[model samples]
Target: MIAPDPLYPVLETERLRLLCPAAPDFDAMAAYLAPGTRDFVDLPPDPESAWWSVATTIGHWHLRGYGHFAVVDRRSGEHFGLVGPWFPHGWPEPELSWQLLDGAEGRGIATEAARAVLDWLFLEKGWSSCISMIAPGNARSLALVERLGARSEGMFHHRLTGELRIWRHVARTATGRKLMEGFA
Candidate 1:
């Protein structure tokens, strides 16, 4: 029988370990959910759903060659959450995204994790561009994208999910070019 490919764990940031998600991460995934953390993911909160989420992350490694990562605390080794190149549920292009546990939010961990993942995607993976999808009502995320130098080109239905919202950014700017060029 063919063995499974080994998980490729990425670099750990100041407060987070940006590593590949694994089946053993189900416990960590379960710990990631709180009252409203799933608001932006399109998936509802439930124990079974958490399993499905982790499985889907594992599947991304095989299908897309990359996907969301398991974010754990550097000092305590606690799972902060998942953050990395997410392509939505069924989209073709990958996007940079993050979700921190309730206690881990508001600490710039998402932004830190995303910056590292985005850098790695371009530098290590040779990817040219990346995007993030945010619900119009999600002001915090929108602000984060803006801080990252992503500018909105307007709204459109997510080709894979058909969800409608104002798209935050198409990633056109000197900063965007610098990021992609740094990889070159």
Candidate 2:
């Protein structure tokens, strides 16, 4: 087993392991993101963008004291995607986000991982609320946010990413107790 790094908080769910961004994760990220699989954003998957993006996640941790996690399969240890709190140099508040690679979809992986991240952000981190920015045509993300009970707060015009619908989410307090019990 790879020893956990002290710098990153490792969050685990029933079937997933959320860890800090690492070098090996670049392989999974590059495969999915580089092929333009996630066409919602304006990211150019052509060059070595995945490497830079992962680097940026590490930097976000340094600058903001918090960032998203690389979601991994518990049984296989495959690094598949990202989930959790994120706040870049921007016009608005902190956001909770999730993204999964191709085969990882349709398995409720995003939903399960999202709930865990929400608990961490609100109960553990003492956050009062969180937001998720969803692009207009991204149907998958739209549904997941609705399932999480997030409500629409209208569109946010990102300086570079253009217009994205902002969904508001309230803090998970002791109400989240049942969700936190089985973490391993």
The TM-score leader among the candidates is 2
Error of 1 at 141 (Å): 0.3
Query: Best candidate, lDDT-wise?
Result: 2
Candidate 2 lDDT over 1-184, as tens digits, reads 1225546677888898787764443354554364334541236664466556767777887777778777878898775677878898784999998867667778998998888888777766777778999999999999999998788989999778899999988764465533333322
Candidate 1, which segments miss by more than 4 Å at Cα? 1-7, 23-47, 88-92, 159-184
Among all windows of ten consecutive residues in candidate 2, which has the lowest summed lDDT?
Answer: 175-184
RMSD of 1: 5.8
lDDT per model, in order? Answer: 0.64, 0.74
lDDT of 2: 0.74
* Candidate 1 steric clashes: 1
